[model samples]
Target: MCIGVFKKENFEIVNNPKDAEIIIINTCGFIESAKEEAINCILEMAELKQTANCKYLIAMGCLVQRYKDDLIKALPEVDLFLSIDEYDNLWEKVAKLIKVEIKSKNTLDYMDRIISTGNATAYLKIAEGCSNRCTYCAIPYIRGPFVSRKMEDILEEAKKLASSRN
Candidate 1:
């Protein structure tokens, strides 16, 4: 049950995150409480961004991705918003914020060199978007139809990650 042991330490797990130039907040939008938590986290990070010299507050995960425009209108502090689909090129956006040139034919190639917390752990994202039409749900609308990534590409990324680190 210890999921933390399986997680990758990509975030600045620190008391003071304002020291970092870029902040990536992976939020939850599954339920009301979760949404509130994500909002509060975003607002807190936004405040940190204001006074801590945090140049960019990149908001990813389900909250912003599911509620794209609404989240944008509510929080103007977030510099970039993306979903699970955008995680593939996540480093690129992060690099752009820091003014670092990630010259790679494929971002995965660059990511292979990046040190991950685990040698056996890899975030294998299979696909993105959804088409389930629920009257109260906006996921289908926000993400459009489900678009499956080619198996070859995914396998390649997995192979790279597997070969590199956890």
Candidate 2:
């Protein structure tokens, strides 16, 4: 959803993170290792400011939404921390930072993407967030409920993708 929205609005998706001007990390805080990995990745990307052209680093996803306050204090190198709830205002925020007028559609299903796979395959994110509650899980609290897309929208997107592939 993030990549699709960014690409739709004309944001360039660099193959390498070091070459990016604005680095947006869509993280997963599912397991302990995933959380650690996400943090390590953020720290690595944050280093680009010293030697590369990296200007803005946006840390988002489950970790950001769930443990935002902790991350804010732990990682002062991050320019912004965007929780999942703030996705609607992402365009305005990015535009404000880059000093450009907002151009992307905020709707999630639009899914205009830069296909890096070089094939007909595409990932269909049928839902946003999860509602599962485990003994040690933080997904439900962080991601909110598991909200599926409308049947009509899903079908329409499937048809569009199938036709494009053919």
Candidate 3:
């Protein structure tokens, strides 16, 4: 969904972090190791600004949602830190940072997604977050309460994905 927003904005999706002008890293903070990995990856990409074409580094997802303030203070090299909740107006924030006018009014539409997995298959997101607040789990905290997409929307996305593969 997030990648879809970038595509809608006509941002070039580069395979190499070193080649990208705007680098966005979606991270996992489900466990301690995941957090470390996310931090390490962000730091690694931050170096691209000095060594390569990278101009802006954006870190987001579960790790940002959980430790945005801490990450912001620790990672001074990062240009922006966005939590999952901030995705609603993602284009607005990105446009402001890059100094570009908002080109897409509806940037989060599922049908606009560029399938990165390949033409053989595509992943459909039916819902987000977790309603069950397990004692040891941090999903509810990081992702907030579970909210299922409407059945009609999910079905529509499924049909779109299915047709695209054929």
Kindly list the per-residue Cα lDDT of model 2 for residues 46-107, writing each as its tens digit: 88767898988989888888789999999999888888788878777767877887555564
Give candidate 3's error at residue 138 in angstroms.
0.5
Top model number, TM-score? 3
Candidate 3's TM-score: 0.93
Distance from true location, Cα of 156 in model 1, Å: 1.5
What's the candidate order when arranged by decreasing TM-score? 3, 2, 1
> Mind giving the per-residue lDDT tens digits that candidate 3 earns over 1-166?
7888887666778888877899999999899999999989998888778889988999989999998999889999988888888887888888888899765675567878889898999999988889899899998898888899999999998998999895
> TM-scores across all candidates?
0.59, 0.85, 0.93
Tell me the whole-model lDDT of each prediction, alpha carbons only: 0.68, 0.78, 0.86
Candidate 2 wrong stretches, greater than 4 Å: 103-107, 115-120, 130-132
> Which of the numbered candidates is closest to the native, going by highest lDDT?
3
Worst 10 residues of 2 by lDDT: 107-116
**Model 1 regions lying over 4 Å from their true place:** 1-16, 79-117, 134-138
The global Cα lDDT (0 to 1) of model 1 is 0.68
Measured with C-alpha atoms, the lDDT of residue 97 in candidate 3 is: 89
- Candidate 2 lands at a TM-score of 0.85
For model 3, give the 10-residue run with minimal summed lDDT: 102-111
lDDT per residue for candidate 1 within 1-166, as digits (tens), equals 0112112324344435767766778787767998899999999999888788688888878787678789888888888887756666766665666676666523333223444346667577677667778889766665678888888878887787777763
